[model samples]
Target: MKFKIEFSGHENIRSNHQKTIEITKESHLTPQGDCIVGVNANHACADLPQDLKEKLKNPDSKITFSIDVGEHNFTIEGKGHPDLILTHDEDIVIRKSDFVCPRTLAVKCDKASDLLPREMVSMLQDPKTKGTFTITVD
Candidate 1:
């Protein structure tokens, strides 16, 4: 099967360009039915608000986002933050056990910051920032 995932947010918090990800079933899904999708840390985490960052640190934190696949639309709730960590040599590693996969979907951001870009931060403060990523499995 083939999977296509798209991530989006409020106009201000949205990525500068269309962000889509593709994964092959044979590579991303394990025999136990566990599916792993790599997220762009720079795009997803670097600009989060301080409170959200704190929330993500908890092992039980959950973030809700919307998703659209062909004619079906729904929401995906993620548990905790991804385990990706950036190293000095620009390599990424899984620092946590949340994701039990052998590979990652994307590179980790250099670091996560409490202060988001002005536009995104304003939207979060005003509570206008909301977005979702669609996952297509075929």
Candidate 2:
């Protein structure tokens, strides 16, 4: 199954957090949101399609999360965990940790905000930049 989110960048995007990458439905950003790569998101945790969310709750499921901004593309490979509840209303978070939370889409992620290409991060800092965030489960 697959899900996609459309979101816009923000001037405050720092993309410096070491463990997680976040996309939020909120339209504004703060410097403290170092893990946030995209804002004004079209989908949050709770808005995901029910079948996709179901796959995301299975520990055996393989999940691929990707982001494309302008000409740059990046991807993270991870797994779903039974612990995932997928109920957060404002954010979708991908984490390198196994800890599951309402906002977490995948755990044991291979990449996070700090590991994103600096060039892509630069593009994501522009408020006018549009990005696509995609999640695929297999």
Candidate 3:
């Protein structure tokens, strides 16, 4: 199953969080929200397709996220846990740990915000930058 989200960059994006990466529907961000790489998201965690969400609740499912910003592309791989509720109204978060929450998309991710290329992070600091993220379960 698959789901997709479109979002844009924010001026305050730091992409410095060590354990997670996030995208949110909120229009603004503070430097403290270092995990948030994109804002003004078109779809939140709760907006994921039912089939996709269903797969996300299976502990044996592996998930892949394709991150695209301008011409740059990146991939993040993680596992879905049975604890996933996929009910957050405004955010989609991918974590490098086992922590589960309403906002969590996938846990034990192979990459966190801090692991993204600095050049890509720099480009994402511009509010004019747009991004597309696709999530797939296989």
The backbone clash count of each candidate, in order, is: 1, 0, 0
Local error of candidate 3 at residue 42 (angstroms): 0.7
What TM-score does each of the candidates earn? Answer: 0.30, 0.98, 0.97
Ten residues in sequence with the least summed lDDT for candidate 2: 48-57
User: Would you list the C-alpha lDDT of every candidate in the order shown?
Assistant: 0.29, 0.93, 0.91
Q: Arrange candidates by lDDT, descending.
A: 2, 3, 1
User: Which candidate should be chosen as best, given lDDT against the real structure?
Assistant: 2
In candidate 3, what residue range of length 10 has the lowest lDDT sum? 1-10
**39-110 per-residue lDDT for model 3 (tens digits):** 999999898888888898888898999889988988999999989988999999999999999999999999
Error of 2 at 14 (Å): 0.4
- In model 2, state the lDDT of residue 125: 89
Better of 1 and 2 by TM-score: 2
lDDT of 1 by residue, 25-121 (tens): 1212222321212222223233334454445444454444333423434433333444432122211222112442323223222212121233432
Off by more than 4 A, model 3? none
Worst 10 residues of 1 by lDDT: 86-95
Give the CA lDDT, 0 to 100, for residue 77 in model 2: 97
